[model samples]
Target: MFNLFKDESQSVNSFFLFMQSLANRNLVAEALKVSEAKYRSLLENMGLGVIYLSNAGTVISANQVAGQIMGLPLNNMVGRALTETCSRIVKEDGSVLAHEQHPAMLALRTGKPVENVVMGLFNHAQQDHTWVMSSSVPEFLPGEREPHQVFMTLTDITRRKRVEEESSLASVIVNNTGEGIVVTDQDNKIISVNPAFTILTGFSRQEVLGKRAHCFQSPKNAIKIDEALRNSRKNGNSWQGEIWHRRKNSDDFPCWTTINQVKDATGRTTHHVYVVMDITHLKKDQNRLGFLAYHDPLTKLPNRMLLKDRINHALQNARREGSQVAVLFLDLDRFKIINDTYGHAVGDGLLKEVATRIKNLVRKEDTVSRYAGDEFIVFMEDVSDTKSPATLARKLIETFNIPVEVKGHTLQVTTSVGISLFPRDGDDSDSLIKNADAAMYRAKKEGRNNFQYYRPELTTQAFEKMAVETELRQSIDKRELVLYYQPRVCLKTGNIAGIETLVHWQHPVMGLIPPARFIPVAQESGFILALGEWMVEAACRQMRCWLDERVPVNKIVVNVSAFQLLRSDFLATVERILREHELSPHCLELEINESSLMDNAEHIIKALNGLADAGMDLTIADFGKGYFSLINLKRIPAKKLKIDRSFVSEMLCNSNYEAVIRSVIALGNSLNLQVIAQGIESEAQKDKLIEMGCNLGKGDFYFPPALPDAKNLTKLMS
Candidate 1:
């Protein structure tokens, strides 16, 4: 019984020792597992994709980051090698990456870290992807020569590489561009600047850095910059427009700027980029072109186009202010004499000087424009003050009292100024210009070198003139015009010297329209050529009829307009008419106004030479009313000069007019030409004109315009 008890005690002690050893072993294993877990957690949290592979190229273990980067799970990727997918293997040229040359394999074989080696990875579900850096290191037994395992680390840098490339491209563009480039933060503070910025603004990159964009604002218009910037930012858009900026030297200049906001990946704004271009010279050139487009070159003043624009603007301003405005149209009275005596060159120089003087006389707000040949227009705004326009106009008239020196010749020239006002004399540009023009003509009619305001009656007269012009165009087509003849009697024998052919209109609905009603109209519409042709042909046929009837009128006098006389083909038209009527050129006389010859001396001389060569006699009609250049008149081929009605009407009552008549008659006799007096209304005027050596006379006092009938003709002759 003693031996059995001892054996049981030994067995229990042995059991207790075994239990303690088992407990120690369990504790050691648990500590090892915890350490391994900590190490694995550190690798996974490094944000690098990590993988473990066995020596036979099979995946042994993988971290979470590695699976996520590769779009795979760590548990799923374990035991699978990257080489299992053929497409995942990287190749140089057409060959796969050698084991020693590949970053991961090289790291494994050499037992060293692979720094930055790029490669592509492929997934069955996701296709190909790129990774920038990868590393592999060997894991081996403590003393073994061959590695049992490998650790690989991979990172993605595709997005970073792309960003670097884009930054490099932007740097190149900013440096090489011609326009100035500037970068600013969202606060409008400068970040960086290009070389063009320095050239344009004379500011260094360092000087402008961290400075507000408005630091270089122009003092003249500084308020606009902040407004523009506010608009740009508030709209979350770009602003491109002109601005006035100041340089480092404090010189104001014009520049065009384009500003845009740069944003981040989160759609947050980071900076503003501005591209600027200096445009001061371009703006100057544009202004110069605009001026040339609307102004006169010779006078350097506003031309008709610019004048009309200014007038429109001025009228609006005046209306807004409830004020009056005046348009003064001035024409030089003796300008033609200067042109004739000293040539057109001197005349042009004189005109330029006159323009300068007139410009000096006007205020800065007034507009001085060249209306047309030897005429100018001045637009005066805010003229509501009484008599101010008249006072200014009088001063202008006095200003021209002095002689103008041109081309070494001191020439005296006078201007006739005509005034028209808004809301009183005219309501629009055309009406104002027209009324002013008419008043200027009235000033000339009242003997020149004065100023006059446009009258309401003058506007009525202008309307009447327009009506007459409109009627004349359709007169011939409507058969409203007729030709009448009055015999020019020989004072000595009381016989018919010749017949004067005059035009009249027997309007279908308006009864008989006198020659005065439509003659001016024909002259204005350039219908004078057609009407003159009819008159010439009619008179020639009438003379031929008289010849056929054995009536003894030697010649027919037909009045021709200045426009018809200037036509190069007028002589041909006359010859055709003479041939068509079977009449002689010797039997026809052309009556031209003295005003027409005075205007176009050279052309008139050529026309007269042609007519004289064709054996046609010319007569100067209304001679005493116009200024006669005696030298030019001698070149004219006129056989006679007709005294106008005004001169003969008051010859007895006014000696001044009588002397002028006598002088004209004497001059005609001395020049070997006959003197005829038209509009010999009273016997007293006729007797006085005959005593003053007038050779012929014809008027309503002798016979009114007769119809083309035998009875009418007999009455006209008698």
Candidate 2:
């Protein structure tokens, strides 16, 4: 029994030993799995590409990065021969490299490691050769002479190589070009210059470095170039023009130059490039043009420069003899209208004709010159008084009154002469010309086609005119102009026949300014065009309101200037305005000054006929005033003839004006036109007009001019 128990105990001990050995084997298997997993993770997460290949130069295993570097999938790289990834090895110049020269194959055959061998490999995925700088090392087992595998890494170098090639090409171009080229840093310091610059400027690269490009420019040219540079900054980043440059030998020459500025990514200037072309040989006529500077190129009359010289000479002679020098500044009245209506070619022809006429009108001793556009200055020496200037002025006006024929157009150009005497108006040429110009403006204000002598007060008026003009321009832009309406009553029915529009400037500080104070200035300064257009538009717009309210009004009359009527497109503008407001053309009436009807009779008649044909009413205004011949009344196409306000106001007191009024009333009746009298401020005058067979009248006695306030316009009209 003792021997059996001992055998059983031995059997239990052997079973426990067998279980311990099996547990130890399982732990060893788990450790191996964990180590291999960590190694694979390291290879996948590393930014660098890692690959292991067999000694045959074939892809064995590769990470994602390695496959991406070769522009292929990792699975494709793993099982494929290297022919799929790289077709053949190539040199840096893209020439075929010998198979023996390949680093991977060499290390395998020579039993030596190779490092850093640049190569061009064809990429199957990219379908192009990829330039890569590669370093390869042979891996060998211990005590083995031959390498079993190659450890290779790749870096792309295509972009860098292309940059080097471009730089080389640009260097060759800069050296061989004929035009001089210069580059400057942001500080305007010279940084680089082409060899052509040295050849043209006689300076080497070392001399001009770190210096301003303008340092070697001529003094006169430097000022001009500096100003141009400032303008270029304002306008754009480039400038092209001609400038004088001084070479190292101090020899000056003209050069046509183009400058281009370069800016960085952050909108800051980085550098500037200058291209220069020497133009010294091309300006052969420069000296010839100098001799013709004193004469006007268009009119061939003495220009402003020569006018000044003649004025000085006349003053010198007058001072010695104690005589007066008459400087008549003659301006063509409304010449701009001619230029605008006809083409400039016709206008130029008219100007030459006027210049010839004035030259013929003056004495041989007088210097008649074209002062500026449509202006002529005549400085007559040995003048006794203002009579000489006045006589010449009258003749000039009379001569221009006759129609000038140019380019199939008969233009009646008129003159407004301003006389300024030396030692009276001014002692110098500049002051004399300036004072004459001021007086010329006065003549235009007093109604053009007349002469005026310069007085000290004209200067004050000139300054005030300038102030008014500046403020008036602002008023137009800001829409500060307001409209006023006055009624023209029918004498037969004692009802409102027409409403005339009057413009007022509602000045911020000066209250309301009437048309009388600023109309003349507006007329002279071409602001009348804007004012006239505004008045017509405002009238048509008010008529639209009246229509909305169903007010009892016949027509709204707008006093249109000759300037507006003579516009080539005035008829179209009126038609457009009426169409916009949906108002009938007959609701608007244009009242033009009688003198303007005769001034440009041909053109005015044409424009009026167009308006009349369009179903608009036309009225000849300020009748029997100014130099109006009764013959034009027959051709005027007017529905109404308004008696001159001045003549009507003076009628009861003056017989001559009453006679003139009666004749005008008779003339209207004979021509089948309505006769309207303006400025009837008394019941007596109104009754007298009725007795004289006048149809309509307008004055304070009927209704003083007030704004057509939309809120109460219907009430006021009723």
Best candidate, TM-score? 2
**Candidate 2: which stretches are off by over 4 Å?**
1-281, 288-295, 305-326, 358-369, 379-403, 442-451, 478-480, 508-510, 626-632, 653-655, 710-716
Q: Which ten residues in a row have the lowest lDDT in candidate 1?
A: 85-94
Cα lDDT tens digits for candidate 2, 186-296: 877899999999999999999999998886677657446566556657768888888888899999888888788889999788988888888876775575476468888
lDDT of 2 at 652: 91
TM-scores for every predicted model: 0.55, 0.58
Name the lDDT value of residue 104 in candidate 2: 67
Candidate 1 lDDT over residue span 1-718, tens digit each: 6889899999999999999999999999999899898988888788887788887777787777677667676666777765653245453233456555766666567766667666656544566565456777888899987778778887877577568768988898889888888888978899999998998889998999999988887878744767877777777667878888889999999888888889899977798888889998899999999998998878989999989988888888878888888889999875754565457899899989999999889999899998888899999988856477788888788888888888887777788989998978887888899999888867876878898889978767767767777877788788787887787876655577888877888877688888786775575456777888888887888888878977777888898876776666889999998998888889988888888776546767788878988999999989988897988878888899998988888888899999999999999998898998888788787778778889888777777668768596766454
State the displacement of the C-alpha of residue 65, model 2, in Å, after optimal TM-score superposition: 34
